[model samples]
Target chain A: MLPELLQGVDTGGLLVIQDSASYSGRHLLQSFINAALNREEAVHVLGFEVSEEELKDGLRGSPVQRLHFHNAYTDPLGWTDHPAFTVHQFCLGELTRLVKQTSHSKPATLVIDSLSWILRHVSTPDVCRTLQQLRKGGAVRSIIGLLHADMHQRGTVGSVCHSATSVITVEPAMRGDEAVAKITKRSKSGKVIQDEEIFRIKDDLTVVVQSKSSKGAKKADSEEQETDPTANLTFNLRLSDTEREAKQKLALPFVFSKEKKTALLHSGPGSGRIHYEPDANDDYDQEDPDDDLDV
Target chain B: MYTELNSILNTTPDSFTQGEFVLLSDRQSDASFLIHHFLSLYLRARCKVCFVGLVQSFNHYSAISQRLGVSLTQAKEKGQLVFLEGQKESLSVLIPQENDTGSQAMDFLRDPSVGLKNLYEFVRSAVSSNGEEGGDGSEEWGPPVLLVDDLSVLLSLGVSAGAVLDFSHYCRAIVCSQLQGNVVMLVRCDGEGEEDEGDDEGSERLMKGLTHQCSLTLHVQGLPTGYCRDIHGQVEVCWRRRQGDGQYTQKKLFQYKVHDKGASFFAPGTSSAVL
Candidate 1:
C-alpha cells in the first residue's frame, strides 16, 4: 500500500497517511522507511510517539544504516550522545531548525512517526506552517506525515488533508481481516487525480496491494460460513395461533405424580408365635455354663 | 486540603502515581477548585510545586490559595513553590487586535514571539531550579509537582493543535521520564457551546487526543438532575492502565461530587440522581 502510494512521489511532494484504530501507522512507517533504505536514500525519522531504539527494533535486521532519528519521546532536554540520532526538544521551532541543519547535508526523505502528538501542543495552523516549511526546504525531497485520524478532530484532519499533496486513508475492511487503503486525493504536477485501492498487511510486515476480486469476496464468504455453521440458518419468531396452541399442548406437566405406600407385613398363619419352643431353648441356654468357669 | 479527593482517587484500582499525566477536563468551568485542592495536597505533602498559570494570573492564584487556606507566600518563601505566569502571555497574544492599543501592544513588544515553544521554555525553567540566582540550597528539594492551570489557553491563542499536542507530549515525557514527578493539566471543554459542527469536531478531537495521552482523565460537569441542588458539580474519572505492549485494560470510571470544602465520591449505585 505504501509503495503504491509513493510510486510517483517526487521532490517537494508531501504525503499524508490518515490512520485509524483498526490500522497501525507504525507498520506503514516501517514499510516506508524500509523502502527508502533499500534504495539507499537517506531517511530521517522524527519520532514523537516512539524512541530511536524502538524504531531500530522495528526495523531490526534491515540494511538501513543511513537512517537517522530525531527522538522527542525520551530525554526532555533533547540531548543525545548517540552518533546517528539526535534528541530534540518537543518544540516546533527546534524541530524546524534541526530539519534545516540536516537539509544542508543533502536532500533526504523525512518521515514523521506521527503528527498527532505535535497537534496536541500547538494549533492546526502551526503544524501546517511547519509542514509547508519542510516541503519548501531543499533538504528533503519528500515528506511523509503519519496522523492517527481517530485521535484528531475532523477539522484538524481536514486541514492536514488540505496541506498534503496526497492523502491516503487506512481503515479495516468491513467484512474481511484485511486492511483497506484508499487514495482519497492525489495531486501530480498541478493535476489532481483521485484513486482508491484496497490492500492488506502480510505477516512479514509488508503491505500487499490487492485487486478487487469477486472470487476473493466469495472465498471470504465461504470462510465466514465455514467458521460459523449457523451463518446460513435463519429462524422465525412469529407463530400462528394454531401453532402456538400445538406448542402449548406439547408442553409437559410441571409436577410429578405421588407413589402409594405399602405395609411391611400382613397378618397370616406364619405371624403366629411359637411360645413352647422359646421356653425349651431358654432352659437349654441356662445349663450351657460357659459363664460358670471363672478360671 | 484534598483529603477527600485523595482518598477517592486512592480507592481506584490504579491510583495516580508519580510520573503520570492527569488531565482535569472542566465541563462546568469549575476545575479551578479541584486544582486548588490538589495543589494543597502537594504542598501539605511537602512536595515542591511548579504552577503554570495559563488562564489565571499570579495574583488570582494567590487569592484562590488564600481562600482555600493555603499560604502561597509562605510556600514561595520556603522555596516550595514556583509560579510561571502563562495567563498573561496567553492573553497578550490571544486578545483581539482591536482591543490592543498602542500602549498594550508596547507592553508585549519586549516579549519574544508567544507560542508553544516559549511556553515550553518557560515551563522548563520554572521546573528546574539549578543555577538560579537563589542560593538558599532548596534547589535540592525532591521532584516538584507540575500543575498547569489551563491548557485551553494555548488553543485559544491560536497555537496550532499539533503544537499543543506535541507540547503536551513533551511535558508528559519530561515529568514522567526526567523529572519523575506528577503533572495535572486543566482543560476546558469549550466545544459544548460551539454551534459549528466543524469546530465542535475539532475540539472533540483535541480533547480525545489529550485524553488518550494522559494516564488519568477526570471530567467535571454539572449534574443533570437539579434534585440535589446542594451538590456543586459532578466528576467522572477514568483511569487507563496499560496491560502489555499493544494491549490496554478497560478504563475504570469513578463518579464523585464537589462540595463546599472538597469532593465526595458515591458508591456506584448510592446516588439515584442520574447525571
Candidate 2:
C-alpha cells in the first residue's frame, strides 16, 4: 500500500510523515526508501533520531549504491564522526547547509529521519521556513520529513503540515497489532486530495492495505441501514373484541354461549333482567362512617 | 442563523456574552476540530475576527475553513476577518546566527517581552482596521473578536511564563475590557515533545495564569477507547465558566465524536451530528 502511495508522490514535492508513538512511520520510511531505490534514484538520509548504524542495518539488503548519510545525533561523549558530515545538535545552519549540498548536484530524495529533534531546538516556523527554502531552492527533488505527531503541539504539527505538499498519518488500529496509514492530505498537480486507508504490516515488512469492507465498515453500513426510512417498519397483528369473541365461539361452542350471555348481561345496567338481591356491601359502607369515628 | 455551537452557547444564560475571554485547551489530536468549530461559528455569525495564527499557516486555515463550509475568502474581502502571521515571526527568531537580518529578527529574538508587545500591537491594529471598514451595512458592527491560535507555541519558542501571562492579560484587556469584544485563545495542555524541564514548568504556569484570567475555559480531551467504527476519537469537553460573583460554574461533560468534518456532540443513543 505504501509503495504504491510512494509511487504517486511527485518529484520535487514535499511529503510529510505524521509519525505516532507506535513507530508505524518506520515501516513507511522503509517503504519509501525501497520505492526510491527501485526507481534508481539516489537516497540521502539526514539522521537525527536514529543512529547511522541503524539506518545502514535497516537498508542493508536493499540494492542501493548511492546511499549517503548526514549524522546529527550526539553521543554521551559529546563527540561524533560521520563520513559525510557531523554537526552540533541544535545548529540549524549546518543542517541546512548539509541538506543543500547533498541535493545540489542531482535530483535526490532527501529524507529527514525525524523532525522532533529540530523542533526541540528551533520553533516550528523556523523548521517550516527551512523546508520552504529547501523546496524553493529546487535542490532536492523530493523532501520527506518524518514527525512524531504525538510529541508536538497541534500548532507545531499544523505548521509542519502547512509546509508539506502531502501528509501521511500512521495510527494504531483498535483491533490487534494492525496500524492504519491514511493519506490525510495529498496535493497532486496543485490540487489537494484527502484519502484514508487502513493497512497492516506483515511479517515480511510489506504493508497490506486492508479493505474498507472490514468489521468497522460493516458496522457503519448497518448504521446507514438503520437510518433508512423503511428499516423501522414493524408488522403486528390486531384483533377487535367482536372478532376475538367470534374466534372464541369457533374454538368452543358451549363455553362461547355461556360467555356471550354473561357479556350481554354485563354490557348494560337496563338489560331487562330483574334483580332482587340485597346490597350487602352497600349496608356496610353506610355504617362505616359512624363506626370508624372512634378515632 | 447561528451554528450549532452558538446554539449550544445559547443554552447557558450568559455563555458567549460580550467582553468575555474564552480559553480552549485540548490535546494535539482534537485541537483542530475544536478550534475550527468555534472559528466557523464566529465567522458564520458575521463577526469581525482577527485570527492570530501561530500554529497553522494562513493557507492551511483557509483550506480548513473552506472544507468546513465557511467562506474565508469572502470574510477577508469584507474586512470581517484578518489573519496575523505569528508562525513566521516566531520562527524568524530561530534563523541561523550568521544569516540573521539583524534589526527585524533581533527585535523579536532579543526578548520575549518584545514579541508579546508586537503581537498585541498587531492584533490591535488588525481589529481597529477591520472595525472601521466593516463593509456590510445591514447590521450594526459590534466589536471585532480576537482569536489567538495556540499560546503554547510561544512558550515552546523560549517565551517566559511571565511574558505569556502578560500577553494573555493584555489580550483580555484589549478585547474584553477596552473594545468590549470576545477573545478566544487556544492552549495545548499536553506536554508531549517538551524535552526541557523548565519549558514544561513555563507552559504549566502560563496555562494556570490564563485559566485564572479567562472567563470560560473549554477543556477538550481524547478518550481512551481509541477509534471505533466511524469515530476517529471520542472527545469530552468540560466547560468551566467564571460567574460575576467570583464563583465558577461547572457544566456537564459534553461527549462528542471527532469526525473528518468536525466534532458532533453525541445524543444518548442517536447520532444527530454537527460539523
Candidate 3:
C-alpha cells in the first residue's frame, strides 16, 4: 500500500526513519526495491557499507545483473563508506555528490537501506536539506528506509515526515516467548495511528501477511503456482515470493531490548529452514537453593 | 542580481547541450538592477540587449533616454521609447530653443508636428524591419526589455483605467510581433492596496479584463511571524493548475524563492496543502 499510495508522484519520494539501531530501514528498502523493479533496464540497487563477499553469499542464485551492485567494505576505493561518525558527517559533501551521481544514472528505484544512520551521522536540519537536494536532483522514484531514535516526539517526526509521500511504522510486540511485529500507517497529523496489524515472524524474513483469509498462503507463492489459469485475482509479478524474506534478512539482527529473548536467525539460498537461537542477557536472575529448595 | 547573472553566464558553458532559459522577476528597483546585470552578461557573451521603456513625462523621458545612450529625438524616431503624452501642452511648451534648432539639423521631425501617429508609425516600421532581417544578425542580441515604470499613471489622471490596460495590451503586441528572445516587463501599481479602493464592481471589472490574457500569476503572501523564526520568510511560488485532460502540470516558465534560506514558505500552516 505504501507504493500504491505513492503511485502518481514524478520524482522519487523521501522516507526518513529516525531509529538509530535495528535494521528495519534496510528491510523496508529491500522490500520496496523488490516490489518496484521489474524490467531489465528499469531498476538498479547500489548497496553501500556491506562487503562483496557478504553480498555474493546473500544474493547467491539470485539475479544480480538487474542491480548495480556496490559494497563499501569490499570496494573501498570507489565506494563511499558509511560516514555515521557525527550529524555533520552524514550530511557530508560526499553524500551530496553520491546523490548527484545516482540521479544522473537514472534508475526507476532508489533505496537507502537505513535513514537512521544518516541522522546519527548528521543533524536533522542538514538531513532534511540534503533530502531536498536529492529530491530536486531527480533520483529514483521512491526512497524507502528505516527511521530510528530513542525518543521521537510527534512534532519532530511530523516535520521530517513532510518530505516523504507515505510512511509505515513498525514496532515489536510480545506474544508469550515469541516476538510479533505490529505495522501502522501514519495519520495526517504525522501520528502512526491507522490499520494496525500484528504478525508472526515465520520464514526467515518473510513479511507478515496482514489479511486473515490470506494469512496461511504466501501471496507471491500462491500466485506463482496458481493451478487455475482463470484465477479470480490478477497477479502482479513485480512483487516476488522471496522479497519479504530478503527484506527481513537485509535488516539483520532485528533486536528488541524489552523482550526477554533475542532471536538471531540465518538462512541461505538452498537451505531448508533458517536457524533461530535465543541470546542470553543479565536480566535473568538464578534462583538460590537455600531460598527456594524443593528437592 | 547582476553579480548572480554574471556568475551564471561565466560558469555555465556557452554551448549547453540542454535547453535553458533565464526566468526572472522582481520589484521595481530590483528589476532595474537585474536588467542591468543581464545586459552586461549579454554583451559579454556577444548577445544583444533591447530596452522598451514607456514615458508619460517629457523631462523624465529625456533623462531615461540619455541614460540609455540615446537622444530623445532618436528614441522617438527609432520607436524604442513611446511618448504617451499628447499636444503642445504635453511638454512641447518647454522644448528648449537650442534643442529645436538641433532637432531640425539632425533630421528629427518637428516636435509640434509629431503626434501618436508618428509614434505608431515608428513602432510598426521597427517591428516589421526586425522581421524582414530574420532577426538573428550576428550583431543582434537577445531581446531584453525594461518597461521603466507603470504606464497607468497617464490613465489614472483623467482617462479611463481601461486605457492603462490597453497600453499593456499594445506593449505585449509589439513584443510578440518581433519575438526574438525573452522579454522582461516591469509594471508598478498600488498593487494589493489599490484593490480595495476600486470597490467590488471595479475589481470584478479589472479581473474580467485580466482573464483574457494567458499568464502565470504568483501570489506572494508575507507571514510576519516567520520573519525571523528561521531565516528567509518571504515566499514566492508559481501557482500550479490542472489541464483540461485532468493531469497535474507545472508552469514551465517560472521559478520561486523563499525570503530566507532556512525557512519553507510564508503561508499559514493550515491553509497550505502538501502533495
Candidate 4:
C-alpha cells in the first residue's frame, strides 16, 4: 500500500516530494523512478542540484533503457558552451519536444531531481504552469518534483505543493537510520488521502517501507516463534489436576513440619538422637539391622 | 599547521587521505582563524593549495600566515599557491575587462546566471595542472587543496545559493576525486537568536546543505556566557569516522583565544588566564 501510494501511477497526476536539508528525498525519487521503469514507463530526470554522475551512480543498478538523465548541472548557463542541457530549459516547450523525441510519444514520468532549483530560478506561477502542463500535457504520465521546503518561501512552497496531486514529505525519523514519509494524495475524484510510514534506503538504492502495524506484528510474530520449546511433541508435557495433586502430595522425607520444628527447638544441649525419615525414591533393605554381623 | 588543531582532529602529520571535504561554519563569531589554520596546514604539508579569497585580500591573509610560519608570497612564487583575489577582481574587472581575458576566475561576477562554473574551472585547472614550472620535474607534490573563504559572500554578490553549492560540488568531484585532493569551504551562518527573518532561506539552505555533505564540520560560535577576555570563542569539532559498516562521530568542544603569534586551543573551562 505504501509503495502503491508512493508510486502514484494509478491516478497519474503531478506528484511532489518535499524534503528539507536534514533529510533527502532522493530515495523516494529513485523509488518512483524504479516503479516507472518496472511498469515499462519511460523516465526522464531533469537533474539540477546534484551532478549527472552522482545521480547515475545512485541509479547504477536500475534500468537505463528508458531512463534519460538531462544535464542541467554541468553547463547550466552555456558559459563555456559545453552543448549540454542548461537550466534555462525548464519550460514546457523544450520538455515536450524532448519527451516526443525520446519515448516516441509515450507518456513518461518526468522527475525533477529538485524543483527548488527551478522554483528559485523561474517564477513560481510559471513553474506551476509548467508542472500543470507537463502533468496534463499528455506526453508526461506524472511529474515528480523534489522541493526543498526550507529553501523557498512559504507562499511559493505552498503554491507549488497545492498544484500537485500527491505530496510526500521526507523527514528524519526518531532513529537516525530511518526516515518518516508523510504522504498526502488527491484522487481523481478530488478525495484527499493521507498516510505516514517509516522507510529506509538500502545500499542498493531500494526503499524498504516499514509500516507501524507491520513492525509491531513482526515483533509479536518473532515472540511467538521464540517461546515454548515443548509446544509440539508426541506426548503431553502438561500435567492434569489429579496428577498435579498427587505429585504435590508425594513429598520427600526431608519435610520439616510444625511438630518437628517444636521438637528440635525444645531439645536440651546434651540431647542427641538419630532422626530417620524415609524418602519416596530411597532404596532400603528390610534386613539391614546388622545383617553383616561383623560389629 | 598547528599541532593543537591536528591533534584535536585526531589526524597524524604524515598520513594523507584523498577526497576529504572540511567544512567551516560560524554562527555568532568569526571563524576565519580556522581557514587560516587550514591554509598554513596545507602549505606546510607541501600540498599545492588554491586559495579563493572572497572575504579578504591576499596581503591580509599573507600577513596573518606570516605569523603562523608559512609565507604565502614564497609559496606563490614557487607555483604552490594560486590565490584568486575576489575583491580586487570584482572591483577592477566587472565590465571593463572583457578584452583582458587573462584569468576569468571570477566570471560569475560578469554573469550571475552563468553560475560559478567558470570559478570551478579556474580552480580545477589551477590545481590539476603539473607544478613542474615551480621548480623540480621529478619531485612529487602533495595533494591539491582548494580553500574558499566566506562562501556566503557569493550569495550577496548576486550569485544564487544553489550555484555556489554546485560550484562546490563540481570542485569536489574534479578537485577531490579526479585530482585526489581535498576541499575546505568556510560559510557564515546566523546565530541562534536570528531566526524566522523571512526569505533568508537561500543562505540558510546553503548552510544546511554544506553541513549535510561535508565529511568534517567545525562550528564556531560565540560563548553563551557573554564576552570574555581570555577566551575568544568556542569551537565544536565533529569528526566522523567509518569503521566496519557503521559510522560514528567524535564531538568535542574547545575554548580558544587568539594571540599575536598564533591561537591557543584548550578544553573548555581549563583556561589558565580565565582562572
Instruction: List where candidate 3 sits over 4 angstroms from the true fold.
Output: A2-11, A17-25, A39-49, A52-62, A69-106, A151-158, A174-193, A199-208, A212-295, B1-275
Worst 10 residues of 1 chain B by lDDT: B102-111
Q: Summarize candidate 4's per-residue lDDT along A26-135 as a digit string, tens digits.
A: 76687778767767778888876655655666566777788888877655556554646666787889998877777445678888877876775688999988888777
Model 4 chain A TM-score equals 0.69
Each candidate's TM vs. the true structure?
0.54, 0.42, 0.29, 0.70
Query: Would candidate 4 be rated incorrect, acceptable, medium or high by CAPRI criteria?
Result: incorrect
DockQ score of the complex predicted as candidate 2: 0.01
Question: For model 2, how big is the iRMS in angstroms?
Answer: 19.8
Better of 3 and 4 by TM-score: 4
Per-chain TM-score of chain A in candidate 2 equals: 0.67
lDDT of 1: 0.65
Alpha-carbon deviation at A69 in model 3, angstroms: 4.4
- The per-candidate TM-score of the B chain, in the order shown, comes to 0.77, 0.78, 0.44, 0.91
Candidates' C-alpha lDDT: 0.65, 0.64, 0.37, 0.77
Report the lDDT of model 2 for residue A226.
70
For residues B26-133, what per-residue lDDT tens digits would candidate 4 score against the true structure?
A: 987899999999998888888889999999889999999999999999988778898998888877666566556557777777779888877888887888775666
Native contact fraction, candidates in order: 0.24, 0.00, 0.00, 0.17
DockQ of each: 0.11, 0.01, 0.01, 0.13
| lDDT tens per residue, model 3, B122-188 | 3334443432345444233334232323323233333333433333333334443224332333333
